[model samples]
Target: MNKILIIGAQGMLGQELLKIFPQAVGWDREEIDITDEKQVKQKIIDFKPTIIINAAAYNAVDACEQAAEFELAKKINGCALGYLADVCLTLNATLVHYSTNYVFAGDKKDGYQESEPPNPVNKYGQSKLLGEREILRRSNLKYYLIRTSKLFGAKGKSTMAKENFFAKMLILSTKQIELRVVDDELSNFTYAPDLAQATNILWQESHASGIYHLVNANPRTWYEGARALFDILGKKVKLIPVAADEFSRPAKRPKYGTLLNTKFPKLRDYEEALEEYLKDRN
Candidate 1:
């Protein structure tokens, strides 16, 4: 059995990973601040884990646009990976890191492949891309970079500044009679549990050190996804489709950020995953 160390264990994905790998050691933000280089190095040295899964990330997309936040994002999302990778190098541990679909420009009609060139449109994507590069460039440790799309799961212990899209929509449904969602932005939706299962499979079966696209099958606009959720919950609301420009946001988003999984078996459909999540939440 591989000794596993899960960083950011309080977040949604991280929490799911803890459940999936119960014997693994878990470190939330309160336990170890990833940006603190000395702490990261010291923890890994003490744990001496055979596998280090970094589910921690600075994912505040809009807030990441500010100069101070940009630097913070770089530290947490970009520079910290180099530190982790360095420790992994010394310990001879395999590092598993999560990335986002925002790495791509989202201009490609057929969705992004692992081979596609990354041209990030926002600071968040740039930071994640930087992290990926740092892991590859700074260390010789075996690594797996898994890129996922829109994620939703039961809330965890982490103090996330923003809620997942599904939770946001559910909240909006109660407070407002009409909801407006961006129709221009299209991407695949990923359930955190499915992602956790896939991560385990990739680790045990593939064991190859490279980039892989892991997400729920099928792509849909935010509007379509929200509509499906409303239907499933038996909530009656008028959902209006609006362009991305109508709702102003701090950061630029990819118009089409869908990812294609050419490496692993496709997970369940987005509708099925959403249904399961709703049931679990209720």
Candidate 2:
């Protein structure tokens, strides 16, 4: 069995990776801190892993809004990636990393494709994209960069862009819970376990490389997803859907950030994936 090291082991996706990688072996932050390159290098040297999955990320979306914290965010999101790539290269191990669809220009007449050039709308996405480029450019280690969207899990509900829009509508026990979900912002929600399984399978197969879009099969608006969320929770609420123009934020978002999974259609649609996720959660 191949030994695997997973950074960000306590995170939603990292936890999923631990469950999926029968060969996956590594720390839970109680064991290591990925942001520390010295520790990362020492751990890799000791584990002598065949595969390295980096799930560490500074994922707080609005945290990037502050100018003072941008550098720290870059260290966690980008520089750490570069360090991981370097360590993986030294060990001659396959390195797997996660990225977001946020890296793209975000405004495409058609949904963004892996082939499309990246133009991040925010500092967080920009840092991640930079990490992607740095890893590819600097490392000789075999690598897989899987770009995912709108991740949700059973743990603490965090606002990973569109998670709450749907989760919020689910708890609408009252007619007072009116949600003004943005119709203009397009997306596909990816469940973590599904993503982890698909990713490791692709990696294990030995032909997976370059950027692959690993999102749920269907494209949707936030309002539709929220309605689905409420429906799944066995609740009925008057969801007051609104346009993206109605809501304003510090960072600009791609009006149509839908990613098309031309490479991995066998993965199933967003609805099917969500159905499985809901079933597990319940």
Please report the candidate that would top TM-score against the real structure: 1
Q: Looking at model 1, which ten-residue stretch has the lowest summed lDDT?
A: 155-164
Q: In each prediction, how many residue pairs overlap at the backbone (N, C-alpha, C within less than 3 A)?
A: 0, 0
Q: Residue 76's C-alpha lDDT in candidate 1?
A: 93
lDDT string, candidate 1, 93-207, tens digits: 8899999999999898789988888999999999999999998785466999999989899887877735789999988888998998999999999999999999999998856
Expressed as tens digits, the lDDT of each residue in 1-282 for candidate 2 is 677888777677877887887566746656876678899788779878878888878766667867866777788778888888888788888888899988987778589878888999888788888888877796356888889888876553223323333454555545465667777778778888888888877886786667788887677888888778767667767777797767766667777788877776456777777777778867
Q: Model 2 off-target regions past 4 Å?
A: 156-165, 172-176
Q: Which residues of candidate 1, in runs, are more than 4 Å off? A: none
The positional error of residue 268 in candidate 2, measured at the CA in angstroms, is: 1.0
| Top lDDT prediction, candidate number | 1
Where is model 2 poorest over a 10-residue stretch in terms of lDDT? 156-165
Candidate 1 residue 107 Cα shift, in angstroms, is 0.7
Number of clashes in model 2? 0
How far out, in Å, is residue 204 in model 1? 1.4
